[model samples]
Structure formats: structure tokens, C-alpha cells
Target: MTTPVLFIHGLCLHASSWDPWIQLFRDAGYDPHAPGWPGDGATVEASRQHPDAIGDHGIDDVVEHFAGVIDRLPSPPILIGHSFGGMIAQKLLGQDRALAAIAIDAAQIKGVLPVPLSALRATLPVFRNPANLHRAVSLTAEQFRFAFANTVSEQESDELHERWTIPAPGKPLFEAATANFDPHSPAKVATDNQTRGPLLLIASGKDHTVPESVTRATLKQYRHSEAVTDLVTFPDRAHSLTIDSGWREVADTCLTWLKQQSL
Candidate 1:
């Protein structure tokens, strides 16, 4: 089946982040759609002052919101999500929805381990102060380069920062940091290899937030789907692999992976 694709962006990024992948999916004859988190329509500067707009939003809220979109779509689309968006995708799989899913730069889900060193380092400024809960924490160009743009050069990093960096919800960061990924954790979603459709994990070659080891750790959670579970890493890329300079290769890899499967 020719499955439609929905691109769920990560924290601090808007739907615009997937601009590179939009046409690629369309050209491949797969429909691509991008939707923002509620209250994300505002520009980055505005969100910095009023983080509450998206602060109260939860994973289930996102899942149901997207489910409504899927319900109205031409078909049960394939899910393509990044970081926090990947968390959203994992929750959807618990519901046993969608045709297939690709989680790019995903955060840890319940039953999966959290190698929080990188993530905590990246998010320390935000969580270190409770007062920052309702505000946007400014990340310097250097900080952004280290946390997110390491693989990409300074020029590209500055450009990407200018073009894509935005205020994100602090609440989710705090919750993910401490939320015990247990059966009772509100963020926990019970997705085995079976409930989720053909699942693929895309890792950036130099992604600091979600390292290769962290991604590999996620594999153990869905051993039942080992028959179909797949992984590919772009060694020269960073966390924003979906929109980086070599993003076409990333998109093509997903396309190639999709074509090989019978979904």
C-alpha cells in the first residue's frame, strides 16, 4: 500500500523543520503532512515569554489530536516523528494505530532505558531552575553547536539555529527527566513489537541527545518485532538529520526501507 506520511516535529521545532522531507515524500508518491503542537503557531520569540501555551499539553493530547487528523486523512498514514515527536509516535503504537512508523532521534519511552547524561546536559539550563518552567531558556550559538549541531559546521549550525531554533516546553523536559518509565508513569505507553506496525529507528551519526547506544537500548523493548525491526545510522549527521544538508540521503534511506517491506 502507498501509505501517507505524517511528520511530527520535535521539541523547540515547528512543522517547518521537515521542509526538506516534505517534497521528498511527495515526490516518492507518498503524501506528507506536518502539524504543530498546540499554541506553536507563534514565532520562537513569542513562545519564550509565554511557554504555558504548550506547557500543559501532554502526550495523549498529541496522540488524540493526531488520531483525529488520521481519521480524516485519505488513509491510515505512516508515522515519522523526531525526539519528543517520537515519544508521541510510541504512544500511538500502544493504541495499535498507523500502517508503519519511523522514529528519528527519539526520546526514551517506558520499558526503555534513559541514558540521561546527554539529554540532561542538553537540558540542564532549563531544568536547573524551577523559575524557568514558564520561560524559554536561551541557548547560545556555541551551546547549540555542542548539543545539537556538532556534526554540522558552524556556518550551517548558525543558519539552522537562526532558521529553526525555538522555545520549547519546559514541563515535558522536567517530566521526562524524572518520570519513572514504569507501568504507572503517565508518559509510559505499552508498545510491543506487535502492536506497532513495522518500526524503524533512525539515528544520527553524531546525535548527542539520542546516542547510538541509547537507540540500541530501545531495541530490547520490542524483541517480538525483531523480524521487522530495523535501524540505520547516518555517521556524518547530527540530531536534525531530517533537515540537515544530507537529509535527502536520510529520506531516501527511509524510502528504501519502506519499499523493502510489505506494509
Candidate 2:
């Protein structure tokens, strides 16, 4: 049977952003699918037209949504997730729901203590207003440039923003921010699952939204687990490494790692 692969996108980018990955994974002898988060419309324009449908969902809600997707698969598939999607992949993998997972520039989960100034600034569009906690928030082109496309050229960044950007629920950001304080925070991941599948955490050195410091701290969270866990850093890449022109390099790196694990 062909191995299955699921691509999970992070906030502000439509699930369609995984289109290139889906095709690439398929060509690599895997069956790949990229499903939108709950409340996401069939298309980016549809989601934008009705922002209310994309608001109010929280971290746990997203985790559960993807878990349901996995339940219908022929078998537990490999997972590749970016940003908040990375966090969701970790949560599912801890539950022993996948064969393996790759989390690229994942958001900070509970117990990850370093919140850099850049990260704070990147998420300021949502945190600046308490009301945003329950609403859907959209990033302006400039905000997207700073937070995700900083390492890329201005023209390319603007084009990407127009192509993939969408309104994202603000609840996950709020939950992650207060996770350390909430003992039962939805942002918590089962990092101690020794029997869970192998996990690879990818970090981009110049990612303002999810700084390398955050990814390193996240790696520490898995130290108690004896399961296969590895970290790879792209020293000059930014948060857009997974979507920008450099995406193929990151994807190829992931493929190489999976082969190393004999997966």
C-alpha cells in the first residue's frame, strides 16, 4: 500500500497553500491530502467573504478536527505541518495518531518559555485588541512581509500575500500566549510520549513569527521522550521557507530525513 501523507497548513494561509506539496508528495509515492481547518471554506475567497466562519475556533478544536481526518484514513499517515499546523501535528502525534510527523516553525506550546520581541511583534495584529481573541484576523501585506516573507523580496512577498493569505482565527494565539499559566491549556502537547512515532522539528533562523529560539525550546520539551526526535535548522530562512521559492529545499530535506529514519 502507498504510504499516506497529510499536509496541515497554519493560520492565515488557506489549505490550498499545500497544493504544491500534495503533488510533490504524490510523485514521491505517497498519497497526500491537505484539508482545511474546521470552518474553512472550500476556497480562500469563500473564507474571506465570510470571516465569521473562520473565527472563534481554538487550539483544541483544531487538534480534534485533524484527529477526525486521520480517523478516516486507511491507516495513520505521515504528517507535515507548518506554523500552528505544526503544533496540531505534534498534538496528534503525541496521541499516537501518525506514523511520523514534521513540524516546521511550529508555534509555541505549553512549557516553551522563550517569547522573543520579534514573535510578539509579528502577532501584534491579533494581540493588540482583546476583542480579536474571538474574531478572525487578517494580515496586511506589510504585516505579512514582516512576519512571514521578510527574507524574500518585496515583490515576491506581495504576490504570495495575495495568493495565499486568509483571515485566521485569533483564539489559538490567545491560548498559546496564556498556555504556561493554564495547567490544562489546550496548547499543551504530549511531549513525553515515548512510544509515539518519530518527530522532526524544523526551524528557520530568520522567522519572526516563530523564532528559532521557540523551536529550540520546543525540542527541549521532547527530551523526556525516548522516541525519535530530531531538529534541523536552516540558518538564513524565514517563516516563509515552507511556502516561498525555497520550499522545495525544505521539502527535500524532510524527504531525506524520513528516508534516514527508514520510514
Candidate 3:
């Protein structure tokens, strides 16, 4: 049987972020399912009107939401996620939920331990507003430049800032910031489990959010599964590699990985 694919979007964005990848996967002969977070809207525009959405969504909430989508599917679906979605994917893997996975510029993997200035700056505005705890704060143009468009052109950066950047839950960022505080952080990505199946971690060398060192450190956490834990870095990419210019390359890489592991 063909293994279905679960394409989970990152924090703030909805399932619509998978539109391009979804169509690409279809051509590759795999089923793709993308799910929205609990308070997410059906469309990006609709989501904007409700600025309070995603503010309180925690890692557990995102995990359960993705698991719910996987449960309704025929069987365990190959999970692919980005950013916060990537953290949720690792959480799902700990439960032994799926057979294979691919994470693109995923944030906060088990061994990843770096907080770049850019990431901190992009997140500062969220923490600045205490009300952001109960309401999502859409990314401003400057914030987008720091977090998602660091590697793109000025025009492209502005376009991305307008099109895709939206209010996101501050809870995930807050939790990620605190991961180093407690030894038993619930938000820590679980990569030590060897039975988690084939997995790939794709990092954007240019990504300020998930730095190369962070993703590399994450590999050590899965040292036992050296063969299954694959890592790739897009030298010219940023945090928004999936949507950045030349995204087709990233999409193609993901499709190829899925084919090798699933098909």
C-alpha cells in the first residue's frame, strides 16, 4: 500500500502553506494531507481578520492536532513539517506514530542549541506584548525580514511579508526559549528513539531561526540511527526555504526523499 503523507504547516500559517508541495507530491504519486492548527482559519486572508488566533497554542496542542489528522488516515502517514510543525513532527515520532518523516528547516530539534540574534529579534515583538499570549501577532515587515526572508531579495522579502507572514502563537516561541532552562523540557524534540523510522532533517544554512549548528547538534541526539537520520543544508536558503525563491528545489528534494523512503 502507498504510504500517505501528512504535510503539517508551521506556527501561524495554516494548511494552505502546503499548496505548492501538495501538488508536487501528487505528481510523485503519494497522497498528501495538510491540517490546520486548532484555531487556524481555512484561508490566509480569513486568518488575518482574527488576529487573536494561534496565540495560546502550545506544543502539546499542535502535536495532538497533527496526531488527530494522522489517526483518521488509513495508516501511519509519512510526516513532513517545517519550523514549529517540525517540532510537532518530532513529538509525534516519540509516540511512534509514523513510519518515516522529513523536516525542513524545523525548529528546536532535540540537540539543536542556538538562538541567533535574528530569531531573538523576530520574536521580541511577541513577548513585548503580554496580550500576545492570548492573541497571535502577525509579523511586521521588519520582523519578516529577520525571521523568514533573510536570504531573499528586498522585493521578495516585502512580498513574503505581505502574503504569508501572519499572527502566530507566542506560546511556542516562549516554550522554545525555555527549553534550555529545564532538563526535562516537554518542547524538546525526541530524536533518541531508534524505532522512529527513516527521517531527514533539512536545514537552511542561511536560516537564522534554525542555525546549521543547531541542526547538526540535533543529529547527535539520534546518533544510534546514523543511517536513518539524514541531514541536508540549503546553502542559499532561509527560514522560509519552502516559500523562498527557488523553492522548487527544496520541494523537489522533499519529493525525492519521500520516493526513496516511501515509494
Candidate 4:
């Protein structure tokens, strides 16, 4: 049977942003799918026009949403996720719901201690308002440039913002921000699962939203697990490494990693 792959997109980017990856993975003989988060509209424009539909969803809600998707698959899939989607991928993988997982510039999970100033600034648009926790928020192109496309050219950043950005729930951001304090935080992943499938975390050094230090901290969370856990760094890339002009390079790296794992 052909191995299945599921691509999970992060906040601000639409599920269609994975179109290129889906096609590429398909050509590589894998069945790939990219599903939107719960409450996402059918299209980016539609999502923009109806932000309420995308608001109020927290981290647990998203985890259950993707878990349902996994339940319907013929077999466990190899998960590849970017940003918030990366965190979701890790959660599902920890639950042993995937064959394997690759988390790219993943959001901070429970037990991750370093909250870099850049990460705080990247998420400030949402955290600025206490009420935003229950609302959907959209980033200005400037904020997008700072948080995601900082490593890319100005023109490319603007174009990417226009093409792929959408409003996303602030709940998950708030939840993640306070995860370390909450003993039962939804951001918690079963990092100690000794029998789970392999996990590869891809961190971008220039990422403002999830810095390399944060990824390194996340790696330490799995120190107790004998299961395969690996980390790779792209020293000059930013969070947009998955969707910017350099996206193919990141995707190719993931493909190569999978091959190395014999998946």
C-alpha cells in the first residue's frame, strides 16, 4: 500500500497553501492531503469574509479536528505540518495517530521554556488585547513580514501575505502562551511516548514566531523518550520557509528525511 502523508498548515495560511506540497508528494508516490482547521471557510476569500467562523477554536479543538481526519484514513499517515500545524502534528504523533511526523517551525508546546522576545513580538498582535483570546485576528502585512517572511524579499513577503494569509483564532495562541503554567494545558504532548513513531523537528534560525532556541528547548522535552526524535536547523530561514520561494527546498528536505527513515 502507498504510504499516506497529511500536510497541516499553520495559522494565517490557508489549507490551499499546501497545494504545491500535495502535488509534489503525490508525484513522489505518496497520497497527501491538506485539510483546513475547524471553522475554516472553503476558500481564503471566504475565510476572510467570515472571520467569526474561524474564531474561538482552541488548541484542543484543533487537535480533535485533525484526530478525526486521521481516524478516517485507511492507514496511519506521515504528518508534515508548519507553524501551528506543526504543533498539531506533534500532538497527534505523540498519541501514536501517525506513521511519523515532521514539525517545521512548530509553535511552542508545553514544557518548552524559552519565550524569545521575537516570538513575543510576532504574536503581539493577538496578545495586545485580552479580549483577542476569544476572537479571530488577522495580521497586518507588516506583522506578517516581521513574523513569517522576514528572511524573504519585501516584494515576495507582500505577495505571500496577499495570496495566503487569513484570519486565525487567537485562542490557540493564548493557550500556548500560558501552557507552562497550566498543569493540564492542552498544549501538552506525550513527549515521553517510548513506542511512538519517529518525529523530526525542523527549525528555522531566523524564525520570529518560533525561534531556534524554542525548537531546541522542545527537543529536550523528548529526552526521556527512547523513541526516535531528531532536530534539523535552517540557520538562515524564517517561519515562511514552508511557503515562501524557498518552500521547495524545505519540502525536499522533508522528503529526503523520510527516505532516510525508510518510510
RMSD, each candidate, Å?
2.4, 0.6, 1.8, 0.6
TM-score of candidate 4 against the unseen true structure: 0.99
Backbone clashes in model 3, listed as residue pairs:
54-169, 138-167
- The C-alpha local distance difference test score for the whole of candidate 1 amounts to 0.74
Q: For each candidate, what TM-score against the reference?
A: 0.89, 0.99, 0.93, 0.99
Any runs in candidate 3 off by more than 4 Å, and if so which? 225-227
Per-candidate local distance difference test: 0.74, 0.95, 0.77, 0.94
Backbone clashes, each candidate: 0, 0, 2, 0
Global local distance difference test of model 4? 0.94
Best by lDDT: 2
**Clash pairs for candidate 2:** none
**Model 2 per-residue lDDT tens digits across residues 72-113:** 999899999999999999999999999999999999999999
Candidate 3, 1-263: lDDT as tens digits: 66788988786566786888888887778888887887888778878877666568877788887888888999888888898887777778767898787877777753466767766676788778766666687777877788788888888988876777667888777777778786776687666676677888888887877777677777677776543888889887888788767779988887787667754
For candidate 2, the per-residue lDDT at 7 reads: 92
**TM-score (C-alpha, index-matched) for candidate 3:** 0.93
